[model samples]
Target: MTVDRGVDVRDDSGFTLMELLVAMMLIGGVLLGLAAVQTSALVTTAQTRQRTLGTAVTNQVMEELRALPWNTLNKGLHASFASAAGGDPNVDGARLRPPVEPMIDEVLVTSTTQATDKAPLSGSGGTNVTATSNPEAPGIVFTSRSYVTRPAAGGESLALTVITTWRANQTADERHVLMRSTAYAPSGGCGDPNNQPYLGACQALFSASAGGTAPQTTITAAFGGETTDPEVDATTPILPGTDITVATMRGGQTGVGVTAQQSTAVESSALHAAGSLTAAGAPSASASTGGEAVENQASNDVGSEGAAPTDPSPVTSNGVAGSLAIDGGDLRMVITPGSGSQAKVSASTVTKCTAALPAGVPCAASDLASAVASTTTLSVGATNLQLVRVASSSITGWGARFAGVAGVAATGCSTVSGPGCVAAGASRSVGAVQLGSASWSGGAASSGLIQVTSYSDSTRVERGLSQRTAAPVTARSGSLRYWNGSAYTTVSITGSTSVTASTGTVTWTGGGYTVRATGQVAVTPVTDLASAPDPAGCTGEGCSISTETGTVSLSVHYRVEGPSGVSAFVTTTTLGAARAAAGFKAAPGA
Candidate 1:
């Protein structure tokens, strides 16, 4: 028995220690493989669930936007719904609520692939932990952000973009899921219920009067009458010089008409009275009562009473004999009597008569001779007739003449610096002259300056004559000529001058005379409408919104758990989606 017992004692009973260890190792490997497979399956299932949840959340947000009114689509997120409600579906009233956060699960269950055993995972995964359950473990998170955009091309429809984003898992390296969707809200229903095939209500256009009353008026179509079909061509012909009449649609519509008229013609003329003549032909009547009787005549007259003398020959009256004749369109009186003891012929002896007495006044021979012999200068302000040495006993009478100072030569000084000449630095007054209505040629008299450039010194007061007997002078182009105490010269302008048909006053400056005239300006009436129709739906006459058309957009992103770590998904809708959601099938390219 001792022979085989030695071998059967160990090898025959069971495996050795090394064999047991090898079997144990094989079993451990199989169990480890099963664990790995189980973990992979769990990851796949979680990721799938996450994707479905993300899609559902995104769609939910888009559906919510589709439910809103087209007008309020751009009201923005977080807008209060309580304020926006109860209004016409076509109108953008305050009754619509803005996009609000939807009630849904924003987080996914924790994934088993998290690095740390802690509930929600720490470090990189900590920030996404939204759930309190198992906060120390890895978990998927979902976040949503929404916004709206208006297209550069404006339209009635709005695009709502909903964006949903989430982490695939609680790991730092996990991918994120993003989802986006859009819907549109558009103006629906007829804007005007009373109008058939309604495009919109007929807007009443009217202009108001000052008294707030509407006047019946005719109005022509600017382009043409309104048309329902856009493809159809419509035109309204407006006849030349014809106005269109507007039919009465409602009460209180009024119109107004205006007219404007302006006239600017200036005419000037002069009247003559007995007076003393200055070197420049300006006359100054004296206050004396002793002088030959003279008759007042109309301006530019060559005879008595502005009529041509019937007798062209000489005629005598009283001791003073004279005759009237025309010379170069001028009237002249001639005395045939010779200068002798009978009468005195001298400028100093000449006297201005206060009254008109066709009969001549008698003068003693001795008195006349004494007046002629003395070389006395005439009074500056005295109104005396210029006496020519035609006869000693009798004298010829000459009428006063008026000449336009504008564009005439000065009589006396040839240059601007001399005695009896206008001073170059002194201001002087010009005699008043009457201007006719035909002087100006434009609207209200334009304020300007009148320049005179000539000078002379002669006492011959001739009617319709501008030149004097003294030296002739002219003013410089830019120099203003004025009369000083003894002479005329250029002076600097110091003040404004006023000119009118009746009177004119001026200040001298630069070698020329400038006269400013003022005329009445015409004013026109303006017509406008008190109120206008609103683009957006109107409660009365005002608009509820500043703009009637706009756009809206929404965005969404989604995240979910995946096999590796985390997975991300994203989607975005186009403008076409907005049109489709708005039920606008007729829109182009929708």
Candidate 2:
């Protein structure tokens, strides 16, 4: 019997049961959407990572394969590095994908020779093995193998392909990446010196005369290779060219000089010739792009003849030994450096810089022909030894190493190259250097066949009628002068006739005088070679590594034989890392 209020009051505080249920459903739905988005993002990130890894693995391995020797590009005897392939990286410096390379672990490597995507011409099928890639891609695995297209008849051009395959844990689809290249066998796979990759320094070398006092010279460019002996036919011409005509030696039957002590030694060359010597200035080096290969050019060289220092313990043999001239000479195993045309050194022993270097840096191997006389410290000393890479893919340098006076304070240290170093001796510097096409050949029982050639465009002697008397008396009986690296050599001429000299042919007609000089070494391809004479070696497993030195040479050319697209020359790779594995594997890629 409470007093009746104006109206009955009611409280509507919280939400209704149905309202709460609807709100809870909305919140749960929002949370679920956020979780789904996060999951999708994570998956996308993982896929991206896998793609990136696959690309890296493909590229790195492709690069490694690209460095293989031309003949070494063939399929392996087995699907493993345990056995020697056609050519081995350790022996021939054929850089296939390194088994220990990062990101991808190879259980086995195989090569297949197929005209199409089918199996190999003759071989056991390739062994399948799971790949273990980087931990970053724990769920993915990669596998790789090489593909070589069967050469066309009479056209030994080979198409090379390095294919890499991969699959992820959750996906049914597999991805692939491939790298490809073409290789040509110059002489039916006998061997090609010019087709080699410069394993050390990318450069060309030529012999030069160290003329004058202590044979002072400044190198503007250089080339390097290993020297081995291989006997050749002594009576026939070894090479053909406009200037080369005869053989250097007239003794020794085929394969007569190969010795049991055949050993390989590093060959180092400074300049093509004294004529190629140029004073140091701004180096004119180059690097590679997508299409172009890498290169280097040196300049502003200053040097002089001097003694070898003791502290750095310079390399005494196979380099600028006292009186060994570093003149850029006109000689080479092949016309091209590394287009599978020729190979002087086994592997690309050196890889040069990405950009053009200044006056004082080293170049890369991709563009360089090679490096020689590699030593613990002497050839690559911190301050004493200075190397300059040339655009022609070689090295040009000057050494100021000089022995210290017995009692005086480094008497002979003054030179054009620079000053002396700590715990060093007196030295002399090279003042100038020149760059040009050049090469050199080693002498011995294992030397390869080479023809001495005389170049004419600028290296020899050639001039248009621009300076001669227009319609005047012919150059008949006119005197001629030519630069022989150190000085101008005057030569006698016969009137309106060609005179054959012991070394060359000199002609003087109504046109200017032409002096052609040539020399040659008649070498036979040795069957008892240290390395395999052919890429397919005797057993097709691989050539037995020579316990002695490996002898190799350039292909033989016969100028006297005439050009029928036929040559008597064959080349072989002889030296590099030589290793053996415990197990033997035999099978061509299928």
Candidate 3:
């Protein structure tokens, strides 16, 4: 029964081709949207990167222009622009070039046109625009214009404009970025090669006014509406015609002529009287002119090399009458009041030093004091350090010499800690007196020699004295008599001695002898009257005696005779006579 059920089996279900196509289309559409988003993100990132590079390039160019010679700038010439190209291996996007190159972006310079009144439509109409070619690089255009401004306080100004433009990728969209900048240069003269070409013929205009003639013009162009005379009015904004012809007269005059207005009621002759016909056919002067010429004359008058006017006080910025102070020639020092009424120095404060003092050194004490007292930064001049005292607890080399002086001393001073005095330190030399007591350590001699005088007694001798510690010592012996309150004591010796002291001379013989003193009276059995005191005991006559048979210790009693007198006695007996010579005496009762 199961085998017979498969008899009518056939395929009935299947996917339609249109449905598959629709699914694929949906997938493709989603992929396309993602691609568009990726492309936009990439474009935005590239633009941001390009903008950063552009800023860097701008800075680099500005620095280069600042360093370029004025004459090079004056020539209205520059290096050629170079462009670079590259591509990614994967996407093959647009190529990128170094932005520093002038051609990194296309630049166009357009000089604004000068309008005039000759043809009412001439100046009012866009005209007088000029373009020149770069002589060095023919392919490049020198679109920047050179225009001269009217006289300024110091001099005239010449302006130049630099313009740059960049284009986006062609396939993506039509878009552009443009930047323009104008700069004015200043200098004393244009002839200096390093400073020349700051501005072209504009610089010469100042010299021309000062009696110098203008050079002949090489380039010239004439506009159809340009007339010899042009009308000037409050409403005229620019000169007539896009291009105006300019001529240079041989006699140093520059005249401009424009075609007179044909249907205008205002006559062309009135243009000259109205001060409207300028060389460029533009307005001759600014409208807000208020005593400016008078002010310039006053400045010139004040700068003139002569005594200023006694009266007619000059008006200052605050509308106050300004007065000038007269300076007394070289002898007087000028004083200026600083912040908070502190004493300060001004340009006029210098005084000429003429004569020198005989003895004392003259220092600018006031100047030094002022510098240290200033609330602002203390600017130290040579005079500011004139009276600075250097001091230290210790020093080396020449500073030590100054430290040994009698009165003067070095003070320790530093940039940070200010200054300090070392009063305890001695000095080698003072104002007039030289110190005689300075000595060196380790037995070395001081910078100065030792000084001595016999006016002091011999007892006042001094030995080694240390300069560092200022103390007397005995290591090196030398005679010195320093000031004492009382009379000097003599340190002298009478005997053989290395160092002298007050005493008798020390006598020594080749062979030693024993000295002895006998009794004043000898013991005699019932001694006769003939017995007497031994003269040997006459110690009062300056003698000493020893008693031992071999080597004996001698007892020397130095009987110093009193200031009054001295006496001695002896016996007449023979034995007594022998003993009397030995310097001993008998007992008192005997």
Candidate 4:
């Protein structure tokens, strides 16, 4: 034992008055280790949350760029396109406008004032400056810089890249994420022919190849941008935004517009109501997307959350109180490169391969080649879709007005009750007078245009105000019973819903939502009623269909999976008719 400062200490490691200080040092060291571990966890969590937000912001910026008229992305925004001298001088030397959203994340320390650097290139050979953004933030600001790659010498596409940077709070290191996208211009630029928004098809989804045998190596999941490793095909970036907007004007004319372009793609301005489309003056010119190195194919979905049940909605009026309004004007689908000598698709005898076509009816084809390889094809006008699908507890208004047979009222207005009368999903759907429901022949090839517009059974009906539920209680599923006069009958709508008495099961036997649109129990599958196939008025190659119309009011939702990548557009306009019976539901509280 050793004596030190009046206390006897046992071993050198043991504690005495002086040695006690050493023991305290050991505890302090352990605590420091623990604090370091805790700090690491907090840092990791913060980064993960910020990364998620950055990803969403990155995708949104790219989508906004794509949504604009394709031309603006090059000349209007980049300043390096169509100047004939390679780039515009007055503008910021061809660099893309950097994306900034103060509301999204931490505000940049130097927001109004910014520092400049050649936007970071995810790949090689990038040497352009003039674009500006906040590379540093006071706390955790996410600043993004963008760059646009004009199409290669024979290419018409425009590549967009966004690099989002954020400085980590713990470490002074700056973290970044890169995202990209591509877009095409519309056809028939009678106004700005050379400066059209899209030089190629707006929805091509591929990347430049490295002279390789296997091309999937450099493909992405959406319209072409930066080509990521194709092996991670499951991680394809999803382009965000609604589909395109097409509306018919007063003089039986239709137009589509993208506000970002600062111009209108008003197609079919002059359809020659008096005579032939080729007669005197028909706005001629269609953007032909024949050249494109299409991307790879994959088994993919747009992030499926399982199908949400269609909410209850009303089918409104066609504004025709009594007139047939059936003197349907002629809508010629003029395919620019069509064989004029051959019968126009509007007058062709093509097989009713409704199944293979947009219509889901099954048909057999004899000449698969002539059948698949048609003279005409579907243009952007025909392929755009406008959809709004959501499941909510709050609903207002109705789609169609229903009355009781033999003076009976449609008792379908019980909002929050038990299992509904109709089948599992929606069994009844009422639509306004539609001009685009035709059989397989080109005469009126209309189906699949408005594939699903339905509402479920368990919904209640209220006129002035929407109903509110205090809490969500499993949203009662399964068959139920309703009062059908004399005896309590398993609920059933005369033509739509039916129940098996022995088993409490409701089933939908009706032809689909669009079938019973107006006429009693009418289910002629809609192929292309509002729009036609070839705008130059030919039977579309059936690759897609255009929604042509003399006059009607409705919302359109168009989405397509092209070359493994997904792109969508949406437009809502009141046609010559009143507002569509589109129902709105207030989402439930968490």
Candidate 5:
């Protein structure tokens, strides 16, 4: 059939023109390597979400400078990153950032600027590097750097550093993002052994010494670390004549040292008088009589003899007469002149009597001679009667008498009581006197009486008296002193006494004395030290930097960038397309 058909060629079915231009250049080179691997996976997912939002904004600014207050941690970097219209340094998007300005670029590193690593983030070198502008991602851009170190001597701890740099679209080939971290400020706390600042914590030093002797005393605590031996809580021991008060440890939470107060002393005894007796003048008597009465001879003149007595007598003769009569049972009588003559006497149981005798010696002849033989003799005519002259008596009978002034011839009698008789005109008896057996011859008398002898005297006395008083004491809490050798002088208590802290003792009883107290410990000084900012390229040539006293070094740096369109590129890269040298060329053409 048409064998000649073999010469008719058939191969025009699609793709020619140089195979469609190499299939549109291999599908536009695999869509430009998938749009450069999706813009390098959106720039590596916006650089891993801006490095996790700049490490969460630098761990929230190192937990807000570790909650500040370790003497304010060098106070720096805040205040909205130091002005650029100040306010809004990422405003609440990354939270935690509020120390408001002290040093957005403070730096004071030492040890040769931390041995350099291009060290000028701000450690006294230069170049602060602030650049902030995020306000929660509006075009992103941030840079902050801080460094501080120079404390570590007695080592309380210090060393902080932070550096952050970021860039997202302000493209000058934009591609910077760095964030280094180091944090520590007021870490763990507690220090200030008097380095002159940072006041708080570390106290325990009390002291006392009143131990010269009485009640014994000595207290000491002193705390530097280890020496334990202090505990005298509700105390006691200052009694003998006491007044005690002790208090120092104040409130709670431990750490109490230096606070003191003390007191004690008082004493008394003396008063007495008693003994007595007194007496003077003892013993008494009284008696009286006169004369006349001699007419008793009427019994017929008792056997005769009447008118022969006219010389000075009314004797009418018959027997004993006139005188000697002690009645009331001291019986002693002898009065006879006839008609009723009497006789009854006795008073001499003689016990060695003597009050003077010998003048005619016959007042009963020596101790009343048995009271004249117990009298009773009467021989009238022969005059043999008895009882002869006796006187000196505190009255027993016939104590006072007088008569015989007619013919005047009786005299005598006077040894004690007298105002009358003793001769002179005669016949008189003053007080006690007795004479018996008639014998006054020309005076006609037989006895008289006058006597008084009594006496007594006594005395004794003793005395002593006193008055003046005050003694009262009490002590609580405590603070009373009188040591006065070098110090301590204040003691005044009486009656209501008071002191409060709990613990008491105070006794008084006149005055016996005792007191000495010394318990001292109270110290608190460090005046707080949070003011150290103003130094970061100061300008007047004084960026302040001279610190060393232990613990306080902080450095912080943070950076973030990722807002320029929230970034979106996954991946991309490609190259390779030149060849032509292996084939010949074509030029001429006529």
Candidate 6:
């Protein structure tokens, strides 16, 4: 062997077929294993990133809620959460990019002041642990506490729980997450009558008549006494009274009564027998006797024996006519016939009307004064009276509804049949009218507080906004709908959109469009990593790729508060996985 058999150097250059096969198989197996491992790692990493995002979103919502005012938090006007990443938007169901817009996955919100019976706990914090023994969950949750008391006091506990879920890779073994929020307030938050905070009087009155009618009334009669009808004749210079009756009565004072005097006859025959008698059988009456004669004669007979008269009795008259004759006060009368009798009488009905004029030239006290004091030159026009600078206060109690011309003034008199200072050819409506004046010649109609005037008039100047009718976009209800310049126009979805109306208010919906998720982040993965061989192979450490991803599902629940505002809540989590080492041990003998 010492024979220079130089290191038996055979062709160590190439591998044998069997060896090659073995190598290929081993490498293939290794590659397959690495791929599997890398795929899992990447998936896990993605899950974790998603979970973190979900958690951040949830926390953001909670923080927002926390910063709200106590009342607002308790009320929780608009608080919600949503996933930032959206699902595939391609209608064909193709895998798209990380969704540019977040797919509304889940949503949580608090719109009503009070929560439903199934609401979660009442607090700013929430638990995620599902195990009963866990004390609280680690997932998003909300809690609330409140106190309630009857007239006699008491209280109870309240909590809320909301959960969301979504499909990951379209697997049946779906993932799901939960979140909850709570609020605490007085138990009787609902203003139901039974649960009302306090009770009100709610009283009613009752009487023998009308069966408890709303309004009540009473009737009274007045008696005419001796004050107006006295014994004095038309020419008799008489004293005020005989001091026979008392005008008024005090608590203990007695009322007065009248007594008639007994008549004494001075017979002419007696006078003749006495020696002082005229030939015509007249009695020689002394001054005192003359006065006595007047007293003996009946001046007025209030009550006497005679045939029944056809005149109506005042007592029956008042009773049957439904009239209450009052004395020493202003009396209110209705022109209509009273309850029983058919009698015609012009009567005044008393009503507590407001100071404003109810109708016509019969001006209210305030308007009357305005008409008199207004700076208008009184000029009787040919046909119509023109009121110039006079202001109209007939509508609002605050002040005048219109301003008169500057140079000219109100020139109407009380003789005008219409309003004391009204314009001619003006249309009238409830609470207001349409008129034309030298100042308001713009074909304007006045409202309670607003004035609709034309912009055509160049000569007549006025200090008011001008209005005119415009054509309608479409017509309905027989009449051609018109826009009063300030009304209806074309509306655009995302453009200069506006709603106008001549008579009604304008409303818009879905003003601010946004998408949110309603499901919970059941599982979340934070990180994942994988390694592969590189060139210069002596089984060296390989290059590695790290990634993060997560999945979350949402419940189908959402709400819109107003045209431009909406809210939602979504569940989220974090997940991660990474290889600590990756390599290939050298084959025993290369």
Candidate 1 vs candidate 3: the lDDT winner is: 1
Per-residue lDDT tens digits of candidate 6, residues 1-590? Answer: 46765576676578879999999999999999999999999878856654554444444443333333333333321121111112112111211111222332222223333332211212322211111111122332221111111111223322223223333344534343333444344432322332232222221110000000000011111121224433322221111111111110000000001111111101000000000101111122111100000000111122555422222111101112111111111111111111221111110111111222121111100000011111111111212211111121111001011112111122111122111111100010011111111221122111211112210000000111110011101100101122232432221111111222232211112223222112111222222343434322212342222221221111111121223222221111111111111112111111
- The lDDT of each candidate is 0.22, 0.25, 0.20, 0.25, 0.23, 0.20
Please provide, for model 3 over 492-535, each residue's C-alpha lDDT reduced to its tens digit, 9 standing for 90 to 100.
21111132112111211111211111111111111001111233
| TM-score of each model, paired residue for residue | 0.21, 0.27, 0.22, 0.25, 0.18, 0.18
RMSD of candidate 3 to the truth, in angstroms, is: 49.4
Q: Is candidate 4 or candidate 5 better by TM-score?
A: 4
**lDDT (tens digit, per residue) of candidate 5 on 1-590:** 55554476788787669988998999999999999999999888877787667656555544443444333334333322323224434223223232343233323332322221122232232333345565555677755544444333524444444445567666634333333333332432234321222433221111110000000011111211213322222222111111121101100000000111110000000000000111111112111121112221111112344421111211121111232222211111232211121111111111101133222111110000011111122222223333222121110110011111111111122222211111101011111112222332222221211111121111111000000010101111112332222333332322133321111111111112111111221111111121112222111221111111111011111010112111000000000000000001111110
Model 5 segments beyond 4 Å from truth? 1-14, 17-22, 49-69, 74-142, 145-165, 171-189, 193-590
By the lDDT metric, which is better: model 5 or model 6? 5
Candidate 1 lDDT tens digits, 336-380: 121111211111012211122111211001011101110101011
Instruction: Select the stronger candidate by lDDT from 1 and 6.
Output: 1
Q: Compared with the true structure, what per-residue lDDT tens digits does model 4 show for residues 1-590?
A: 98667777676554577778888989999999999999999878877877776776677656554554433444422222223223422223333333332222211111111122212221122222213223322356665554555534424455666666666666777676777666544353223433444453221111100000000001112322224422223322222221111111111111111000111110000110011111111123112211111111111122444421122111111110110010111211211110101101010012221122211111111100001111111122223111111111111111111111110122221332211111000011121111212231222213312221222212212110111111111111222222222223323222133222221111111121111111111111111121213323211221111111112122332233333233332222221210110111111110
> Model 6's lDDT to the true fold?
0.20
Full-model lDDT, candidate 2: 0.25
Where is the poorest 10-residue window by lDDT in model 3? 266-275
Comparing 3 and 5 by lDDT, which wins?
Answer: 5
Every candidate's CA RMSD: 43.3, 29.7, 49.4, 32.7, 60.1, 48.7
For model 5 the TM-score comes to 0.18
Error of 6 at 133 (Å): 34
